[model samples]
Target chain A: MGKLKLAVGVAGALAVGVASLSALAAENIRIGLIEPLSGPIAAIGSEALDNFNHAADRVNARGGVLGGRKLEIIGLDNAMKAEKTTEQLKKAVDMGLSYVIQGVGSNHALNIIKFLDKHNKRNPGKEIVFLNHSAVTTAFTNELCSFWHFRFDANVDMKVAALVTQISRDPGVEKLYLLNQNYAYGKSFQAAANKLLKERATDVELVGDELIVPFGKVLDFTPYIAKIKASGADTVLTGNWGPDLHRFVKGAVDSGLGATFYTVYGGIPSSIGGYGDAGKKVNLKQVTEMHENQDGLPEDLRDYMKSYIEAYESTWYPDRYRWLIEQLAAAIDAAGTADPIPVAGKLEGMTFPGPLGEVKMRADDHQMQMPLVVSTLTSDVPKHLIYKGKDFGIGFKTDGVVERADTTLPTSCQMDRPG
Target chain B: MEVFAFSLFNGILYGMLLFMLASGLTLIFSMMGVLNFAHASFFMLGAYLAYQISAYVGFWPGLVVAPLIVGVIGAAVERWGLRPVHKFGHVAELLFTFGLAFVIEEVVQLIWGKVPMPYDIPASMNFAAFSWQGLDYSAYRLFMLVISVAIFAALFLFIAKTRIGLIIQAALTQPNIVSALGHDVPRIFMWTFGFGCALAGLAGVIGGNVLGTEPAMAITLGPIVFVVIVIGGLGSLWGALVAALFIGIVDNLAISYDLSFYPLFAVFGVERDVTGIMQDLVRLTTASIAPVLPYFLLVLILIVRPRGLFGTRDV
Candidate 1:
């Protein structure tokens, strides 16, 4: 009887330990959000946070993920700097967040990718997955494609390619001046456009091209605008967004060059609201249609975006950026599990119904190669007009778009595969 | 001729604005021997204040009230923030101001958030200022030029004529002697700092309409202000003026030209790519020069003539 009692005690203790472990492990999905919250890009960062949190709340309201498992979001501010991103990403790993939804910028994303790959290789069993919402460089999804990494934004090449193809047909644009932000993404856009222009439009005259400093200094545009006007170029194509564009445009107009036509990238909410009228008056051809915004898709598929936008007035409400986050979340859901390794595998050729339209993350490069919407700015609208202008009829070339099959993953990224 | 004329006109107009920000910076540094990194932040604050004020009271009242408030704030900063850090040396003072800049930026964001304010040109200045060469120039920009020049003239007269100005100039020239003369040297320093800040605040008010009142405006404008000061040298108002104009002209000219021109390598049959490596090179070279030109010029001038153009002494 004594031996039997001892045996029963040992069994009970094992059962209690198992019960505790099970309770500890019970359905908690932690998704990490890395953005530049405290730095110069904090505005954009805060917006991203608002967007992600809103989506997370919506997802949680609909019974969480994977059958009643509560989804939790962990936010880490990388200050939009590369070194800081690496440090914060390590902190996320330490916090035991297996999945991450990151912000824009290639350098920051690259840093996280390096850390995740190394950590996963070393630990083997505990894999961390990174779902990128901000970094638009093709490398995250291309040759440097990690099984643990997935990208949501359309790459630099695709965005510029779509705009350039449509702009090339304009007869008035005999000569063009190119101004871009000086960085990897900017350089890539310039490079990609050059390649496409060479392959296609031979008549386009290359006038003065220049790159602005990254996180550019406040500059007087008299000289630059004068140069553009003097170059006798009919049109200008620039790859700068936000405050820089605002300053540049005002300065350009001030310098007596308002008549000179130009195209700028990275449309923001404020600019859209205020200058949408100006853009329409000047007939700015902006790219808006092809992303993951719900309005860009069919009626049945747009309910997710429509609901989110209706609830959140200014954040994800029919915007390009909100669509990006939604697509990323949907991709995680499509994999049936938010584990980066399996989810990243399922990301390829995944058709996610986003706020913009139906987007497919290509299997080859892992970039979402959706149709690019060419919009013109109109002065009459309350919001910055994307498609209304004198040249409204010539929308972005939806047909000439490079299919996902044409884009190869970047050749530069060489990573060791996981066993 | 039309393009050159237009560019020159643009260069001068831009130069005047640069002078407004740069002159204030140069004066403060001349008076205190401390590069106020927070100067641009004050300018940004001025813009925000004007935006808020103009919404309630008209633009002209905002113009007056913003600078006065900024001046008072600057005086407070000098008394509390910079004075404590001054004993630690100039570098420490600069670092303190840098920290102040960081804080001010965050505070601005906290107050205004990240969105750009709708601070449009006033109805009075909305029409064309003047037109030449088939181009319609904005009245607001013209107004900016007029106001900047007026401020410059007023500043010149004040420094040349007033008793406080004389003391400040003496401090810039001979701090020890000025102290020996019993001018309450620290008080003069405080007033000068406040005055410089007021000028920057005024610039911000006018600038906000042209450059949209946004939190990040300071960061974008900060380095260029420094560039203007450094190129102007540390303690000379005149040098600052010349450097600012030079920068304005060079920046405008650089962006207006083709990027394929290598002063050294014109021999290579450089094929221009509209969107490729060459295109990117052009864009980078032309666009980045304005912000860095003053720095480059400063370094070159230091190497050739250490005191900067028309400067009294080495920084």
Candidate 2:
């Protein structure tokens, strides 16, 4: 009789445990962050993860999303390879995850879009939505637009337009030169620069244009700088990032070639390490979403940036991520279901508050329309910024903010909506 | 005319830097008969050590202290790691040094992480020393050129004039005879290997100041150093200098040219089309293929003269 009573009590306890476990699982929404978490670019992946986690925390702290259900971000390492990305996507699907976020490489982005298009068609009611945070290829939305994909960052054309606006305003930029990495993105950049300059700043003369291999190939850029100097180009525009950009700028400074450099990736504080004082006279300008050292930044946003810098020790993260999460939560709440199909429908043509005011996702192309800021790397900031245990004594100052309407570009995205 | 002069100037400066790195490899390969694959890693290690020491003390002390540390580590490797493997054969020594290179790079990455350290030119030497045709040559570069020449002269005098240098030269060819002279032949060999590594470390101290001091830098410079020694000939120190300068000038001139293969093909009456790989090759520019020009010169030399110019004998 004692054994029977003991067995019965144990079974009852086990039944209660099983019931709560199911309830707990149902109360959480898992979004897969498929990115390179282990490889050369792992630091970038983990930094993006931390930012996303903080965004989720902020959303959850605000009474949770979808009637108090928690948001869970599950990282799946792709090792920065395309094949591994496809495998991670399959794992996410098999695990019943409906949404995955990836943005480091456009190759991986294209892989996810093509994989999901077939997978969704083969198996109805199991659709996955791709939320892109930073892959900025213009053709992704314009030519290969997908109904299931939503991009939060501005594309190349919009960025070029913003830079050209600043160029037209500057009387010093009379002779323009274009130097870019010889690849698809670089070719697009050259095209965009030429097209936009013709349209916006026709007075600026293009004196020299050249393309070179990306990185690891060019050990010294002095020869190239000499050519630029010989061309008598007073202003130079380049789409080079990483070593290519920094080394060229360093060579220019060492050569004392006093031409202004308008670049794509010079705004990042970490990339321009040890180059602050040297780069001061070069008139380095970059186009981006926002800068910390604006003339009249709002107190709340300033406090927010201060807190983030205190946590991360560097300001290399893009601000569009926080905006991405806040907008996502709003879309989920409005849809009243965590299913990606209905949630994506709600996300299209959505508008929410951002650091720079109203941010929108255009229904035609699923591209986010937001205000872009053109900033110059300078020692003379309106406000001094200290970060990473060193008094930087330098910050990116706001040249001006291109309004959202001005940032919006026309798209050719024709989509097939679901029934 | 100005472009040509400027490019030539830049080429000579680059060639001298290459010689700074290639001289160490030449000593090891020619004197020791042991291909030290981890040579560039020693250079990398020297740069990293300098950066660390410079953070504590000033740059000047680190410049001395870092190379000493690197030399000590290299000597220990000769005593413990390479000496045992040396009896196995030349292939074993090659494989051992190759493995050592990988180990050093991994250890560097483990400690330093992936981001580049702020190892930059010292502010005291960061001014334009001269200007020609409105283009300034930096003081730091002048310092580099002086150091390279000084190193070349010192190495040349030490090997050609010093008593120990004579003994070393004798030991390489007459190891048994020198061993009979009541001297420690093994110890001399160990020190010679260490000295070769120290030269690389010294090169790293200056090279990292301008090029960069990262894990990938060793790999980037490793192949070019081998090119210098091979083209210089198997055992010629002077040959290394001449070959390095040749490659450097040719590389710079190649990069300065914007001319394409179009003109060459048009002269041959081969009209370019858009469809084929041959057509694309025809459209390729000289500046785009400048990185491969060194190897092209190497192959051309090997085909015409396998022994190499000024080299006493082939390896």
Winning candidate number (TM-score): 2
Each model's fnat?
Answer: 0.51, 0.38
TM-score of chain A, every prediction, order shown: 0.80, 0.90
In Å, residue B26's CA in model 1 sits off its true spot by 2.0
Off by over 4 Å in 1: A1-25, A168-176, A198-208, A231-234, A252-266, A273-281, A289-311, A315-338, A354-357, A379-417, B1-4, B85-92, B171-184, B257-290
- Listed per prediction, chain B TM-scores read 0.90, 0.95
The models' CA-based lDDT, in order, is 0.68, 0.81
Q: Measured by TM-score, how close is model 2 to the native structure?
A: 0.89
Worst 10 residues of 2 chain B by lDDT: B112-121
Candidate 1 on B12-106: residue-level lDDT in tens? 88788888877778878877787899989999899989988987987899999999999999989999988888779989988998998888888
Candidate 1's C-alpha lDDT?
0.68
Instruction: Give per-residue lDDT, candidate 1, residue B18.
Output: 88
**lDDT by residue (tens digit), candidate 2, B1-315:** 766777788899988989998888888776777888898999998888877787788678887888888888888998999999988988999999999998887788678765556677777888899987667888889998998898889888878899888888788779889889976887888888888888898888887767777656787778888888888886678988998888778778887876787888788777777467676577688887776778887787788887788777665
lDDT of 2 at A192: 91
Clashing pairs in 2: none
